[model samples]
Target: MTAPAALAGFDEVEAYHDAWWDEIVAQAQAPAEVDIYDKDWRFLSTVDDAISGDFTDLYNDAGEGKLAQLAANPVAQWISENVTEAEDLHVRVTQSHTEWAGKAQTIEESMDSDGFESMNISFLHDLQHAKKIYCYPNPFFLLQVQWPKIYPYFGPSVTGVKTLLHLNLLRRYQPFWRLPADIFSKTAWAQDFEAANWPHIVNPRGTGLFNDTSMHCIIATRMGNFYDVVKAILEDAGLQLTATRWLPGDEQPFPEYATITMPTLIWDVVDKGGVRGKTGTLLDGFMPFVRSILGDNIQETKTPVPYEEPQEYSEDKWGTVKEVPAVVWYAAQRYTTATGTGQSGIVKWRKTQHKAIASAILTGGKSPGWVNTGVKLIANAILGYIGMIFLNPGLALGIFDEQIEDVILAFARADLTNLRDEMGRDAYGEYWESSGQNGFSPSTLAAFRTGQMAVQPYTSFQVEVVNGQPYWYGMHAVMGDRVSMELGMSGVLYTDQIRTARLTFGPNDPVGWTLAVGKDDDDTSPTARLARVLQAVSTIAQQIAVQS
Candidate 1:
């Protein structure tokens, strides 16, 4: 459940003016061209001047001993010389998030509390490590917002400004698929994961930002066979394992459940799809990163226009846009039934404040905003409907986001049924055969994972006989949507990848100015803004998915 955002015609129109002015001045882009290609093979980002400043003042201001240790390490020095050579590229090598798992009590307690990792399940500890890593809200997952039906009415300036920001977001977003492997390729998390007994889906090249990396995992066990499998690998990767007798807070009898996480495989992405840090991807061959691939930094920022504080609706004066849940938005037509006095014109997305426009448009009314966004939204809705029709495939991913995602991992449903093999097929085959569906049927057990959603990948697998060759069909589920086990007769699967899925959700994904989107724990960095919009797109994807 999320607090709503409101957007009205006047405010939306005003912001349109600002974005238009900003674009005319070319103030909405990267600040400078970065020399990142030389280090593109690795999934690392060049530190910007801001991060460099933080690095320079780190020891005196932050007293992080890890930097002191790394500044002395030979490997760290080598990384500095070859990869992080830019003044802005200043960084320090630090240990992975294995340390938390080494100690067992936290796991025990976190299980007791209603908790799940907020970011990608597997990357939870890394993100929290706070030395080299930082956490951003799952930008795609905001629960309460949706795109409006009147979008076809917005003027060109409004659409143009939005398109500009949206395109920039997409460009910045597409290349980040390479970071996980760069962060973890040298560690045991990736190594042991590859050798594990469970069937897993991984990009053959490495971890993909857009690929599903979930695999079957036993989150915790008294049995060494299961425990050792994870423990040894994690320990080998220098991660510590935790054990417990009681749950985290209350003295509840806590047992273990299946836990899995996505892993890195960047080399596979390039070797296979050739998305080597390029804005656009070419599946047929490699597209190397060059200076041309990276855009110049945005040095100047447009000062945002502010809206007057929203007062209660008054007919004489226009009111703040009404906000409502996307699922129940149509019910809000009472707020602004189209009077037909004048044409339904472009609405204002409130400045800084998020509000819904009054429902003024009569049904079937025409507007450029609707014409523009309506077609796209309808197309997306149709696709979502088709997805639901194919398989009520009873599993999906969700996180209980307390402003940020690492708070909790939850399933939409969880009912366990041991497939009684009446017709005598393998477990999955028998189950699907009995159910008369190609995948798990809708049930309580639709989506369930033990720990945080971001760090703990759900434990499920798809066995596909592709051309008589048995393969593990990748399993990816996101919050609020039906389980899309779309083995699409090709390697292209569902959009559990937040970046891919949210954009696919059309209007449900909140698209507006960076600061106006759901607050990313108050972080306004370009990366954080990217996380908000990009993650919001995918986060809301489930909302669109379930509703459409």
Candidate 2:
């Protein structure tokens, strides 16, 4: 069905966002006097309006066929609208020190006055110093003190903080890849079931879960960092990067991954189980785990098929021809333990039947010491599972699988290595170091430690200072340093680093007078931090209510 005509047009979307922001500001300015519930409804209404317009459905009627609809989520819409692929992107990692270091003594002396103006002046100085370092004027500094008096409930309303966190989590924990058709393809798995005289055993339909449409919305919009770009370059060169299979479901929605009966590699068994001799066929020997959601009807294949000329062998860490398994047993989908599906029959079926099948195949008939069996018990903390993807056309899901930090650092190292190679002794002047102390200047840290400052801390990379300036380098959308300003600072001091320089170029701010912060990841800016704090508080309150 087409979207309703009342849906907002493209030109009106930005205006709609502005109106919502204005309303949020007004509500935050006088929350006690405003109808908060009504405001919430209005906010939801705005989201509905933003999503009402027809969007390009990436996944064509994938499982439950709601992937397209789910893509209309506010975060997805915002990312789709705002973030575009960059071409010939040349990010200049510059070296420059923060201007605040010079004014440190002045701020400290002003703090001794014990007057309100002194505090205000110090705060302004910090903001000015912060602007020199951060991409925008530090909003956290502006709002931290004034929020209590001028805007009581302003923190949670800020955009981009939670989204950035979610993006980081996805990039860090659940990097994605497309499922290739040849090795673990739907066609091959289905053929195996039919060949085993269990035609009715495995379902043939593609769940469309790993399809580009389903995974693209979750990833491309989230990972626009330089690391992601480099990873893309590496993947284009045929490096199947391994990432944690953090998604908590044992049962794979894809039918190809439903059963575990592929011809096992000798090296694979030796690598996983440690070298032990004497066995019939490789398949019979490696049936340590196998469970099917289709009950006893789906029996394990006893007779093993010989390797019919292994086609696409991937190189392992040692550069050996590694036969990439069609589907890794442990890296399947899993669901919550909560048994009774809530009221709706659809929910019940999805929770019970679909999940049971997914869980069953995911477990693969739990053998001793198998991790997939208890996947739901332990959350993402257990980083044992590995998520793999197929990068073939029409089969790839757009998800980042590598740690962004690692990618960025690798780039820096590569760039530095090249520079050193080119200049020899000339490049020895500057170097890159990880930002350990949450990307705060010594003055900023001291101020925050003493409760004199309320700005959020950013964890960033630092390069050596050359010619009195610190070098700065980061992507257009960088990860925010997730330290809470409320928490007391407890880390070693770092100074004259690259982070003290601008991380991103503001397209709109030609003069750079924009008083915003956390534009990179959009999480640590004062407003973003405030919103995060408020959300955290709200969550705590909700938890308390539930406990009570």
Candidate 3:
């Protein structure tokens, strides 16, 4: 009888494997820009730059030689010719930490008691003796004492000593172990040490402990010395270092090295958006979104402020003066709280409104139509509240027919069930049939669709303008399926792609408004600031009307 098909055989299915491999390669090579924008609207250019630099440097510096060999002696060729030998070499290099630690200890003891007069001399001796050693202490400690004048000659003396110590220790304990005795000769070692420490001796004004230039200098110096050491050792072993050396004319090495020094895409959305190369704007489309939320008694004039008091009848005092109603500052503070920069007044305001709006939109049973209606209602409510605060009360009452009385009438007129259905359809797919399966109650579904999943009883509602025409927007909170509390005619306004207004309502009763007029001609008008403030108030009133 034929043996039943083994499960292990399925793993080697050629077609299946090939398809997966293709997908993997495509994913690896995908353009990076797609992931540059995160959910919170934060830019990821700086993070990408940091990760890319680290990844490329590690691969090129450590694996370039092996990669080159793989070209001439392909993987298939190597496997067929010297698989066993390669396996043995890999095994030898993979020695256990315990075994290596013992060997390192022996070497350390051998060089420990060398009683050198100066710290530099003792350090050099220990470094030479160790198969692998890393100096943990800062090099500045020695530099300050041995060469006091030289301390100021180097860049900012923050962590240079620590870095030098780390690199020197790595040379002694790790990479140096790979070097043969001929490469470890006194002259080569000294040259390597000097090169490794030279940059610290030069530029010192670093913003952080590890400056980029300083790091580059350290790496180049150490690598150059290491190359020399390896070259000498290879010659002694009847192998030519020149054979491994990537000559100046070599394209392969140059590309790999260039990759190491490539500037990362560092972007600041508030300033310049993307990686800059010496001149010109680095970031693209990075201007801050500016809006005049509220202002009063403001006037625009071409005339500059007087430097001195004007005489009683000075004719020079004639200039345009436009009256503004009130003044309100609306700003976007992008400073990160993670960096310990506490939230600015503007940022705090944004957070409050964002949370409130999110809560209001996502609080009801699951129904697409109902959900959309709810979202619109919630937006309307938010906008209405904002409008009421800034709009004239007489105008607000006319629009709603009774101001306070009409606010409740509008909420009662809203088809909560239909609104829930619309919201679900807009937010979730049509496939979501409210089957009462999955323990989903109508109210639970509504809440989930609206994003009001919290068990603590709360109300969900919103207000928004439907057409290009201006309208009242507001919301009311309810508990136990009944309106327990309401906020009315708080703010006003309609949504325009070119012009937008935002108002933030806080628990502490703090209120703020943002009016973005875009690049319109009216924005520069003498009464622009006051107009903005009035617009914000109008929007706030509309929000309160719906919310209440």
How does each model score on TM-score? 0.16, 0.15, 0.15
Best by lDDT: 3
Compared with the true structure, what per-residue lDDT tens digits does model 3 show for residues 252-349? Answer: 32221122122111100010111222322211111110110011111111223433312321232321211111111112232233532332222211
RMSD of each: 30.6, 31.2, 34.9
Runs of candidate 3 exceeding 4 Å displacement: 1-77, 85-166, 173-548
Total backbone clashes of candidate 2, pairs 3 or more residues apart or in separate chains = 30
**Candidate 3 vs. true structure, TM-score:** 0.15
In model 1, where do residues sit more than 4 Å from their true spots?
A: 1-28, 32-416, 420-424, 428-548
Best model number under TM-score: 1
Tens-place lDDT per residue, model 1, 1-548, is 53344546667789999988666334222132111112112324432221111010110011111111123334333444564323222122211110111000111101225443111011121111112111111212222332331111111111212222222222233322322333223343343233122212212222233332211122211111222113222211112222111112322221121222222111011111111232332221121111111232101112335433334322444333432111111111232445322211112111132221111111111123323344445555665677688865322222311222211121122112211122123322101111010111111111122101111112332211111011111111111111112222232222111111110011222211110111112233576468546644653343233323
Candidate 2: lDDT of 384?
Answer: 28
Q: Candidate 2 residues 460-506, lDDT tens each?
A: 32221111011011211111211101011222112111112221122
